[model samples]
Target: MRPGHGGFITVKNTLLHCYCVCGKIEDAHHLFDEFPQRNDLISWNTLMGDYLHVSQPRVIVDLFKEMCIGGFEASVTTVLYLLSAIGELGSYLGGESVHGYCIKMGFSYNLHVVTALIYVYAKNGEIDLARWIFDGVAVKDVVLWNCLVGKYAKCGMVEEAVALLLGGGLVGELSPGEGESDVVVDPATSSLNLNKSAEESTPPKLSQP
Candidate 1:
């Protein structure tokens, strides 16, 4: 169980992260609910984040509602993952809601947030919107390149996708096996669609969401 706000919460964070990465939602939720520190936005996000990776991303909708009711203001990171979860649901309404919030709050310009937005739009079949976002980015990174390329390839925009993939060579760091590169494996990918569960986990399940 979680104690008062000041003590051991950091330890809880470490274990909770492990639980999330290992697909132990039940244990993660148990520890999360038991924590008195649930009043904090970070605590809620940490738990909410774990729920986003699993197949049941809709869980985040209910949790976000609770977070709002609890008066925890949403941050750029919060909306980023929430958008990812919404994307997994193929729910444009939810995605638009988050996008509206991001724009209203001036988070639309944040690099990672926009990247996630592009992904959500692309995954939801809003390729035009995804391209719009991608085009607006003056200084693009490899992660965005992978996303746009993947989505374009997925959407059958082969020429454009191949062009973008090949264009990376000019950046000099890109190579044949892009996924093996450091930038390709950035933690921002977790912001895509993360939810942890015991069913998909190996031995010693940490959480049960």
Candidate 2:
């Protein structure tokens, strides 16, 4: 690698991300294609993430397939973006394949990854699988708890949702200030809303090797 080439790639990737954030999908793709280090996993993930942000989930799935064919190793960030896209598309099979891959890669236990998995399963109406995943996590955060409970409510399991809300010790857990505001439930409407934490939306910083 030539001196400053890595820096140049970093700058270009940043510009690509900015384009995506600004909703300039075409410009972002063009910038991504022009990169000399376009093969970098970070660049692929960034572009895919941007496509997902713009509601172009189909684009993300295609990009993911291309990235795999290019022999790029997916990081947790990549999996999260892919899972979100799959969830949007309601593709149970695709979610399952990604879930299997996460287990194979040892990423299934990661909190963010697990949360994404729960989302994909729940969105696909596989609430049982989502609950199983929630049960598998011994140490649960409010986000995880809220995810399952909210999914249950959304699935019309109001009784179970209320039970988990009142009997599952979530109220007690909130007293300690652990994601208290993230879980909101309305008994009258039997509606549950789980606000995503900042960490859930922000991709981890990438360090170029």
Candidate 3:
């Protein structure tokens, strides 16, 4: 049986696991604060992961910053968490700085890190930078290709989107490419198309909801 009152690291890990499983982040923080020993990297990252799972991604960034202030060396997983949070937050400057940090840390060669960077840049309206990253990947997957193509189409870069379709490099599982792939239209894409029509319509000033 585990001790009722263990060392701070052990208690922190137990609380973190409980938080992750039960999804009670507030209680987790309470336990974290009650511990006398400073939280190690695992404690910080575990809590950060819990925040990510809860869709409160922006919290992950603040957690990472606090980890740094506490003198904990961030793991690659911590960097990924921060990047994911930045992507969700649409904080382009923060994302760019994180990207540079990853590069300086020699995590530039890590595929997952690179992909997150590309995705963050693309989602933040830097599609060209996303494309540069995509092209540099020696083994491009279908998901990466689809992300690049869809972003191009979403941004009204129709020609580039078409070129991606025509390149036949990779085929996505959910959304298909140009000719014979049989694509399913999602509501968001359909609504975006409708918005584009509204912008191009006669007089161009349509009623807003």
In model 3, which runs have C-alpha deviations exceeding 4 angstroms?
1-11, 36-38, 172-209
lDDT of 1: 0.66
Winner of 1 and 3 under lDDT: 1
Number of the predicted model whose TM-score against the real structure is largest = 2
TM-score of 2: 0.78
lDDT of model 1 at position 87:
71
Question: What TM-score, to 2 decimals, does candidate 3 have?
Answer: 0.72
Tens digit of per-residue lDDT, candidate 1, span 71-92: 7777765776677678778877
- Candidate 2, after superposition: displacement of residue 39 in Å? 3.3
What lDDT tens digits, residue by residue, belong to model 3 across residues 1-209? 23355585866676776876797888777766665256777787677767766778777888888778877876566776677678778888988898888778766665555656777787789988888877777665454566677777777888998778678544344265432211111211311121232123222121232
Q: Which residue pairs collide in model 3, if any?
A: none
Query: Candidate 2 or 3, higher TM-score?
Result: 2
Model 2 ranges off by over 4 Å: 1-6, 172-209
- In candidate 2, clashing pairs total 0
Q: Candidate 1: where are CA atoms >4 Å away?
A: 1-8, 11-15, 18-24, 35-38, 162-209
lDDT of 1 at 8: 72
Q: Residue 26 error for model 3, in Å?
A: 0.4
2 or 3, which is superior by lDDT? 2
The root-mean-square deviation over C-alpha atoms between each candidate and the true structure, in angstroms, is: 10.1, 8.7, 13.8
Predictions in order: lDDT:
0.66, 0.69, 0.64
